[model samples]
Target: MAFNTSGFNPVIHSSTGGGSTCISGNVIVSINTPGTKLLYEAPQDQVAVTESFVELFQINSTFGADAAAGGSSVISGEYSIFVKLCFPNDPSGLDKIKTVQLLTHGATLDYTYWDISPNYSYIDVASAADYATLSYDQLGVGNSDHPDPIQTVQATSQVAVVHELVALLRNGKLGGYHFDNVVGVGHSAGSMLTQAITHSTRGTSTP
Candidate 1:
């Protein structure tokens, strides 16, 4: 149903052409979840944040942002997210555009994990199933801004960023293509993040 692509390119676009769809670029998003953002703007403060990150991981308190701040703080950053849209190479693939599957990868990995190689690709599978697909780099990962990983890059803020991306998908901002439905599909921590986004956007948000 969707076969559109344009500028906003940051990562590589397919050289093969026409069998699939892809749009990528740097997107700046502001997430308000309460944490420290000041450290990233300074040198020594950045080191302190890194040290704190190590300590938190050592103690399994990576979710300690809310506890440390006793509340929420604004965590905003410029992120490089790619919406690799899969349109079926076949004519019937057009109907796949009606519903989109948003893909997110786990920690120690990025979006490309889903499309490991030509031998196996989730995006290709979704396309063949008549389901449009979406995959992006999680905020603070890959080409995204590394905002104080211990504080600003915690669960709350990351989930909020996903919500923002959902909104964009619904609004047809990534490319000229838009879908009537969207489903969040993730792996490990990425899956957990999607669950949080689903719970939080129950009121009035789409996708």
Candidate 2:
């Protein structure tokens, strides 16, 4: 809820897409200090479905501006940016598939996961079922790789994997493992998967 005012600045940029050309030049401005949770409001002009913006955050090295000789670089601080699209008066114009694509593509290039320091890690839910199978195989007593059997449900597709993630995030055996430090990021359809898991986690009581 509190803002990180010590080191903070915000920049905004805009562009036109779809079949239209860029009308107004992209805008960029810096904020002296801002809240941790920042929102980028879309512009009123360039009201066509094609115009959009992107937000980016730059994280400075924590160690130092420059890496010490024969040593690793450090992170100094972090920078964040957000961009939005301006659409015509049409209530549903913002939700159009083409407009969404333009916005997504622009934002993707502006902000990349790899740019963030201390690379973030996530549970590989894509192959959760495979991991479960391997876990079961390792538990069998007959095989050298086997020891004891553990119960697991099969997750054949991304949807199933998402369901499993939601269960774990909510009331599954590992539910207690949830913590504030965790961050979730997904792309394209993966975003929907994360949303489903997130929705399932809400309003659930801890055992």
Candidate 3:
């Protein structure tokens, strides 16, 4: 992705989490239902799971094939994610990075959505304000790993990855670029994802 960092370090991080959800297009509607708490957990060591998407898909859909089963969507296995960061052009010149805007893009789009500088460049504007910026692809999109659509990559899984990144940022583990005032910015469906992150996390996120 084209970056505005005249002179700075850019950091990329990968996160893995799985055995999360297995949803088809129909189960998507239940996302907003009340009392819908989902499972989302990851290892701190960053070790990815070895199961394949195809295998997980078969198992999740084969619920009726077993005595205790019926067709299902709750998924299993390790989920991999990728995210990129852009620091201010001159870190020394800026005050201890005040605001960090975490960018989450919508469907069919990669992390490049926020970097389209010729248009409304979120990165350029934030960088001009000395804000550290992070833009990432959802787990199943962009540079992140691709898994079975029915076995993983649901809204909960997507939000789970965001939470993981927040922990990394707060702890100063993501490429050494740390900021307590992290903000989430998203577009379209990503806006929904950012809203999810904000509700689940203590920090601020703008949809």
Q: Pick the lDDT winner.
A: 1
Model 3 lDDT-worst window of ten: 19-28
- List model 2 lDDT by residue over 1-207, tens digit each: 111111112221111222211111111222122112212233557653133321122344322222122332221121122222222222333223121111111112322221222223111121111111001000111111211111111111222333332333233122122222222344554455445445645686211
Provide the global lDDT of candidate 1 against the true structure.
Answer: 0.65
Q: What is the lDDT of residue 10 in candidate 3?
A: 44
Candidate 1 C-alpha lDDT tens digits along 99-171 = 8888888988987776665646777777656776777777668877665665566777777777777776677
Q: Against the hidden reference, what TM-scores do the models get? A: 0.73, 0.19, 0.60
In angstroms, how far off is 167's CA in candidate 3? 0.9
What count of clashes does model 2 give? 18
- Candidate 3: clashing residue pairs, number: 7
Q: Which stretches of candidate 1 lie over 4 Å from their true place?
A: 1-3, 10-12, 15-19, 35-71, 76-82
Q: What is the lDDT, from 0 to 100, of the residue 145 in candidate 2?
A: 24
| Model 3 stretches astray by more than 4 angstroms | 1-77, 118-120, 202-207
